[model samples]
Target: MPLEFEKPILELEKRIQELKETARTTGVDLEAEIRLLEERLARLKREIYGNLTPWQRVQLARAPGRPTTLDVLEKAFQDFLELHGDRAFADDPAIVGGLAYLEGQKVVVVGHQKGRDTKENLQRNFGMPHPEGYRKAMRLMDLADRFGYPFLSFIDTPGAYPGVSAEERGQAWVIAQSIQRMGRLRVPAVAVILGEGGSGGALAIGVANRVLILENAWYSVISPESCAAILWRDAKEAPKAAEALKLTAQDLLRFKVVDAIIPEPEGGAHKDPERAIQNIKEALLKTLEELKGLSPEALYQDRYRRFRALGVYQD
Candidate 1:
């Protein structure tokens, strides 16, 4: 169920609909009243959304209507040229990669995609990549390297596909190879966790010079549900597990897991997707500008240090 504040927003929408029907017969000046109610509802939502718990933020991040990779692609990139096939197997829809323009800057774009509807979700394997998907991503990484174009990746997935078919084709090997190849790629690369960044699936393309995460998005070594099931024998303990995971953007930055956190609008990126995209655009432009001048060898050394320095402890 949605929160209490959402009820008034729903009610106001219902009342507006009824008023519209009544207007056909009574010719009443309901527009003013409807607008006022809408404004009031908006204020109420802002109040409720102002202070959200970690769990509430998690809910917002996984909201079904949240924007996907394609949504952001259409918004922030132009002149896209999609490449196909892993040259080893069939094309995998779970991973999408191609060349595109980021504010007229030629760049290689890649991301995990989870479809919005049932059929599409099934087709996308619930955003879990198979061996072919990882291979395809590595192919694109090579393309980006050869051309000297900056690489941009979006991370969003539960995990890599764990089905028999995927494993039969060596899923683990492909994922590891992707990361291994990325570490040596001679280019300025940036990775953003736009949604769920689960396990090695997210890590496949996350090796980069600058890693950015959305304020509510999560990036974790293992998913909370997976950890709960293993530890407590109940997936319902995921909430508690999430508290221990420290996967949120701010937490990730504090742990030295990522370079930066991109703030979302009030509530989260879903509250206003355009605003979220704009914020991401600004961050990417800034990072690219900052890293563009570094030599390829310098970029590689920095990327290695960035990953090596994560989650250190000293006594």
Candidate 2:
């Protein structure tokens, strides 16, 4: 079911689908009706999506049908060879990465992977990576740097795994190491926030020369629910916390936290994932082109300067 705000759009879409079915079954001329309904659907979608609240946008980012890292790979890349394991502990399914070809250019692709169903989600650890995942990512990133392959990362994790076993495996240390390694990576790297980007888990793979975000994605130091619990003593105040956090793409763009925003389809990315994937492909190509000319030292320096320039304040 669509969210409350999207009911009108979905209703109109349903009507259009019904009209098509009727036309097919009864041989009635419903072209005019279908056309009118589609126009109204388009307008309704634009009006609703364009005016979404931060909390509403957060919901959309977490929508079940939203494209995942594996989906993006299947749609936008070619010859993907998934590399596994950290060569230390076990292979973590929450983080997936390997060599892939993007528009014929060889690149290293890495991202958080959340599953589409309950069983898969459990297998993926709800996309909350453990220490092994971060280490595996760092290993692939180092390989990319060594082989002169552009590194592309898709971030969509709730946070690092907080379970006792993850902590026992030095989760914090591995996350810190990933961040440190990414900061010094000599190759061109780009990261896109496909959905939720929470805390150090997201940042571990997010230190890129270019950071892009989907229109409805949210990136924050903490989840709104968690922040609300900490500040207001109740998780029910999450909507208010979301408003105050400025985690939306537009807000982050204005604050210079993101490099670009790739606009989603009318309702959201989940509603039209193929279009969203196409938009992302275009953005990646353009960004890669822009970064192709820089020397390794220049790439490192530019990435450093980009992060350094964030959080300017006037008091």
Candidate 3:
């Protein structure tokens, strides 16, 4: 079912579909009717999406149909040879990475992978990475640095796994180390927030020379529900928390937390994934081109400077 705000658009679409079906069955000309309805649908989509609230955008980011890391990899890259395991503990399905070719340029691609259904979600731990996941990502980053392959990361995690077993495995230390290693990475790196970029789990792979975000994606220190619970003692206040957090891509762009905003399709990325992936491909190529000539020292310095410049200060 469509969200409350999207009901009108969906209803119009349903009517258009019905008219097309009737035309097919009865030989009556419904072209004029369908055309009018299509125009209305376009306008309605623009008007609704243009004025979406932060909370609404958050919902869209978490939409089940939104493209996942694997989805983007299949569409946007080629020859993905998936590498796994932390070489210490077991392999975590939440984070997937390996060597891939982007527009014929060999690069290391890593990202959080969320499952599409209940069983798969359980396997992915709802995209909450564990210690092994972070370690595996760090390993891939190191490999990319060693081979001089530009690192590309897609961040979409709720947070690091908070389960007892994950903590026992030193999840916090793994996350911290991943962040530290990323900070000093010798090769050019780019991270795109495809969906929910939450807390250290997201940041563990997010330190990049160029950080891009999808139009409806979010990057935040904490999830809105968690923040709401901490601030208002109730999770139902999440909408308010989302508004206050300034976590939307647009907000982060204005704050200079992100390098660029990759535009999504009319309703969202899920509506037109091919177009969304194409937009991401264009953005990544542009970023890689911009960073192509930089030396290793320059890459590190650029990344350091980018993160260092991420706060408000008054002269």
Candidate 3 at 257: error in angstroms?
Answer: 0.6
- Candidate 1 regions off by >4 Å? 1-44
Quote each prediction's TM-score: 0.88, 0.93, 0.95
- Deviation from native of the Cα of residue 43 in model 1, angstroms: 5.7
Q: Any runs in candidate 2 off by more than 4 Å, and if so which? A: 15-39
Pairs with backbone N, CA or C atoms under 3 Å apart (clashes), candidate 1: none
Which pairs of residues collide in model 2?
A: none
lDDT (Cα, 0-100) at 96 in candidate 3:
96
- Order of the predicted models by TM-score, top scorer first: 3, 2, 1
lDDT of 1 by residue, 168-259 (tens): 99989999999998888899999989989999999999999999998888888888889889888898888788888887777888888888
What are the per-residue Cα lDDT tens digits for candidate 3 across 101-135? 99899999899999888899999999999899999
Which of candidates 1 and 2 reaches a greater TM-score?
A: 2
How many clashing pairs per prediction, in order? Answer: 0, 0, 0
Best by TM-score: 3
lDDT score for residue 19 of model 2: 91
After the best TM-score superposition of candidate 3, give how far the Cα of residue 280 lies from its true spot, in angstroms: 1.2
lDDT of each: 0.86, 0.94, 0.93
lDDT of prediction 2 = 0.94
Position 240, candidate 2: lDDT: 99
